[model samples]
Target: MARWSNWSGRQRSKPVAVQFVRSESDAAAIVRTANSAGRTVRVAGAGHSHSPLVVTDGVIIDTSGLAGVISTDAQQRRAWMWAGTRIHALGRALHDAGLGLVNQGDIDRQAIGGAIATGTHGTGASLRNLSAAVVGARIVLASGDVIECDRNRYPELLEVARLNLGSIGIVTRLQLELRDAYRLREQAWQAAFEDIAPQLESLARATRHFEFFWYPQTDMAHAKAIDETNAEPVYPLAAEGERCAYSYEVLPNDRPHLHTEMEYSVPAAHGLSCLDAIRTLIRRDFPDVRWPVEYRTLAADDVWLSTAYQRDTVTISVHQDIAEDETPYFRACEEIFLNYDGRPHWGKVNYLERETLAKIHPRWQDWWQARERIDPRGTFLNDYLRRIRPR
Candidate 1:
């Protein structure tokens, strides 16, 4: 049997066939043929998502073949590319065209399609996730029909498609709103947990981009803040110096290690309180766990399924080495996430259920109706989607 696994190796699949698709017609054909043969279909991106969204025993379509920049609207500051384009590749291409993505998460190895589908983001109180840059998309539906949607045409579809969790349909290409390329300067520092924890909100609000990783073993927080700059580019190898470079260069961290992670977004107003609770929980029981707890922020967005939907958000991420049993550590933090009205990142580890999801998202039913209309029989639905997706 042909097998597939994610970046962290936490989820795996033994698909009957792993098909690499190049064109929209080919993608549509595969979906049609799979449904006719009664085999569920799921498309594979960079295979970085931690969730079991793509695990299936049927056919898995690889989007790597369908990768490249299609065109750019330099005048409108917009660009669209085959959804399979990797974030790092896209950044280089856009930078060549004098454009850059507005924000990015720590890892840049993910395909742009997967990044947008999962609401990937970076740290900034005013910056929205990569999904928010989506101005439109070309989707190949479960029925083998292709359609386009944006602010002008099929506006409702754009709303749900912004962060569809790969359940709506196969997005062949995405149109993104770009910004004139910009540079950023970074300053790294370390301090005791007491020093940063109390001033977390002020620090986040003051910096253009800010985040900290609290190392549980030493009770020290390694903090980094980056701000827009016109200064000469300076690249440093040490933690105490200042580094200045393009936004893409300074924003993402290449986390090369294999690890299982869980992240949740809570209300911005309650960020410190939530962090305090998590800090207490870690110190009280799981102090021996050697990984750090991550803290970041995201501005509000209108995407119906977005964690920051209708409110500013503070995202907290916890990680464990791949070899460790993450169950006990993750479950305990999950209780705190749930208590603070936290919404889990779709691409990460989460235990959210249907009833809980509906209660949290005001437009939950609307998103489901839109998805069902696009793929009524769930030809694209997986076990994970079925569990959390509203009926």
Candidate 2:
């Protein structure tokens, strides 16, 4: 089978010709196939990432066939999903059953397997990233063995697997904690960028899902509020088969176009100042360029490496039309995030190396150690792991 390693059809790296592996047993068979052939192996879900997380020259195990909703334990508020299930499918299925994930990122096309591996998150003042909801997982080791791990069974491995970044092993299944079905009343509007800093924190506290976007060189900002309340709620439930109109489409309907974006999570305390700094720099240096700045809020989570690990966060996402030169603006924003100890979302573009990533993550050492024990030969690693834990 032909396996192409690419992201969103934008950037593509080397091809790791691969075949679909349907189940844990099928994954084991693929491992045996690669091992016997003396070829390295890697596993990828929907290939939604912008990074080279799965750029391998050897066998690539396609896990989409390993799809299913194993079960849901309402009492425990947990659900078991196969690794390759897409986020949209999972969300719709769960919603139909009167259940929903605690939080979900804007795009639902990413596979659950890939989302958790890369620390993908949705905006919310009270919701954590998807990975943090993972209570346990079924990972296939390099030795062709299936191992079920959790905080108790393999506590060490569980710590690593929580945000493993596809470095440790091939995750075949995931056990996630679920929340009661909820509705999000979305309010989209424009606001002045200067006025957002002081009010950002208070606004997050008032809403459940709040995200906004800022454009470079512009003082204008676009914000969305997805709050929960029994009061008169607007924006009725999205109809079946209707796709969510993303920020880009929602704003400037006549001039919809692709855009480049970068997102970061700052400590709830540092949020205001972070936004202030960006505005100050933009207003002072690049006042001519204009795009709306987007912000979103998410609740705290318990995962060791989650963005909202211990503190609440306000995610400020900046975007520029794809046709525009975004490198300079993105570079400037990266510097701001670095100064504020910002944690970049894994699926998005970030220039963080292992040394830098280690500083932001206290569990980095523990995760790498466990990964070594699980995949000593680095069977599941790609260029991304090399960046995170260079040889």
Candidate 3:
């Protein structure tokens, strides 16, 4: 047996065997063998997810061997990439092809498939989550069969595959709808929490990307805005206050600190109130919570399991240093979020179960039906998946 842990070191697993797969056939064979023996299988990517989504005692298929860009089509603005490609690597490859990812989160260490699988996203009023950019995918099923799905082929399956929780199958390749390479000008500064609270909506709509980090116990928040520009790239270390750089350079930052995070998305209408409530709770009840609270927004998408599904959303993320116990703080925040009818980010920490999730996601039943059709034996399910999305 081999031990595995996520990037945050919060979730761990011991699998009977760890197999590094380089192709679709390898993944399919592992799944088929595991299924035949009545055992479950889990695919481990970069392990960036804080959730126990990858924890399994069966066979573990490590997808790192499948990394890299497979092909690109400039005419259609599409790029086919192996599932294990890291977001940072994908960005560089796309830049070389005169294209770039439509959007990406601040941390670029996540594997491409894992990022989209959990509905990972960046902030912008008009921008959707990364899963929304997935136009096609090739999933290897437990029966040793590979299925290629897209809007034009197996469209219903494509919808489910877009943001699958890795329940349907092992996604070997993804065809992302890309955009022409672009440059962005970013401005970062500090602002009083009260001063920025009321203007969140306007700021989100006006900027290409807008996000903020509120330092607990302080009245100030670090706000950042990134907008497209035609100007020359500005040195990232320039002290002129504003920096203009390629999309990839400006979008991601060096996250030297390690922490565990819990994020939830509430309807756009309840965003402000929820944020205010969280701020008050932290200031009054959990003064010891030192990690910053992150705030961002996302446009609605049709992906059934997406946090922003069918409704524009405001995302709030609470983080705690890896050395501290996050349970109490996260539990309190989860209560406030649930009051606002928030949906938890799949990859992040959450306490929701199937009944609660079913209430928030209208398409929950439909998504389960699709999963049943694709993975009848539940070969991809782990304890975490079974709890949140019971069959």
Candidate 1 lDDT for residue 208: 89
Runs with alpha carbons beyond 4 Å of true place in candidate 2: 1-5, 229-259, 283-291, 320-326
Tens-place lDDT per residue, model 3, 313-369, is: 999999999999899999999999999999999999998889999999989999998
Candidate 2 has a TM-score of 0.87
Please provide the root mean square deviation of candidate 3 (C-alpha atoms, Å): 1.5
Give the candidate number with the greatest lDDT: 3
Q: Kindly report which residue stretches of model 1 are placed more than 4 angstroms away from their true locations once superposed.
A: 235-242
How far is 124's C-alpha from truth in model 2 (Å)?
1.8
lDDT string for model 1 (87-167, tens) is: 888877888889988889887899999889889899899999988889999998888899999999999889888998887
The C-alpha lDDT values of all candidates are: 0.88, 0.72, 0.89
Whole-structure CA lDDT of model 1: 0.88
Winner by TM-score between candidate 2 and candidate 1: 1
For residues 1-391, could you state the per-residue lDDT of candidate 2 as single tens digits? 3547454444455544677888888888778777777777777888877667777777777888988788887777788899999876786566555567877777776789999987888776667787888889998877788999987898877777778778777899999988766654456777777676567777777876666777655556677766554443234434322214322112112223455567788887787788778777777776765776556676777676776767777777766655677778878988998898888877666777888888887666766777788887777777667667834
